[model samples]
Target: MDFGSSLGPIRPRRSGRLGDTVVTYLVDRIVSADYPVDSALPTEPELCEEFGVSRTVVRESIKLLEEKGLVRATPGRGTRVLEPPGWNLLDPIVLEAQIRHDRELKILDDLISVRAALESDMAAATARTIKAPQQQELADQLDVLADLLDDAGAYAAEDVAFHELIMVASGNRLGHAIIHSIHSKARLSSRYNGTPTRADQEQSMAEHRQIEALIRAGDADGVAVLMRTHIVGSWNRRRPEVHRSLTALPTVE
Candidate 1:
């Protein structure tokens, strides 16, 4: 195979470090299945030539790929692309690449399910523990969402803020951190944040108001149910129609 053509043009350098560029290009190839599972990556010298980077940079890039579980390096066998199950999906680079190549929308579906599960639990926690001031803050965020209903872009941004505030109020720092990392990267995908109509935004705002009411009333169970419903429902409404039949997305209990 013509590895250079398969990998496409070397990306323009985005930083002073050449290794980062090489790593990103190689990651794109591996995740896109340009280099399929168990396939050997181009030899170091070949990579160096293709990427126009030094052998040292190529080696470091391979090292980074290995660290991300995208490849395995052996002294005599060279580096081979690993199976998808082995990949460090949480790594921003890997996740972004996977999202780009997720033709079936399976990853995005799974992403929404995971987000719903975590955010629902966090919402429950917040409802149980929120004091008057925190309740007021969440109500204020709902007001912000209402104001942005006419602006899809701004509404989407504040939509995220409203969810994050609930996560923060939950006091589940680990859940909050996990959601923060994945949600930010997931938003980069068009499929994940599908274009929302004004009607869609209005529905979402109404749901947000319901969530805030449940939280303010200290109804943890109600909040959890509504939070999960809101998230999964929003995704269903905006989910791209192109691949709807390919696979059914998992549901949250």
Candidate 2:
């Protein structure tokens, strides 16, 4: 009862109603696989058999994929997976296409935005009542940031823990909820890429310390400022970098 992916480079003419057929099969497969970015496409025969169509039908089907930048055919090399902009990852179809293709998930962008929103709210809540131990914990994390910052993966992990602590300091049920929605793609990405430069980590640690100081002073606005700076700063750092693989990133811890 499963329909094949009609979304990508299915051959036209041989396959009737080019767009619908291509979209159906293509969308189904991508959705099933979660539309990962930069992943490889299935063999032509696979699409043919799956779609209950001929090779020409499958060939035309993939054409649509090329238009979306979701796939390409190398003639003898068959098809390679691709997921570039305009794939509408925010759209369910593109998301599935990227995931299906095994493209690197656009994790950093989403995760950082979530952190900005969650941490900012957490900082505001903490300003109302930050406990003595919690304040010290924040300070300790800042110091730790200064120390083991040579390890980017560890630094990212600690960064997440630091932000999560702010949520805990808020002393509200919403804290846990925020953590659940907030993701750790940044940390996971760091781990995948191994460690970055010590200088990078040091700068990050310094930023955390500044935020901790603001939180300790019960300056919600100041904490908010620092949190925004950290989030935006991290985004700016990674914005220039490119990633490989589009899906199945380590779940945010």
lDDT of each: 0.86, 0.62
What is model 2's C-alpha RMSD?
11.6
Candidate 1 segments whose C-alpha is farther than 4 A from its true place: 1-16, 243-253
Model 1 scores worst on lDDT over the 10 consecutive residues at 244-253
Among these predictions, the greatest TM-score belongs to: 1
Model 2, CA-based lDDT: 0.62
Off by over 4 Å in 2: 1-28, 32-108, 180-182, 190-195, 240-253
State the TM-score for model 1. 0.90
Per-residue error (Å), model 1, residue 146: 0.8
Please give the lDDT score at residue 22 for candidate 1: 72
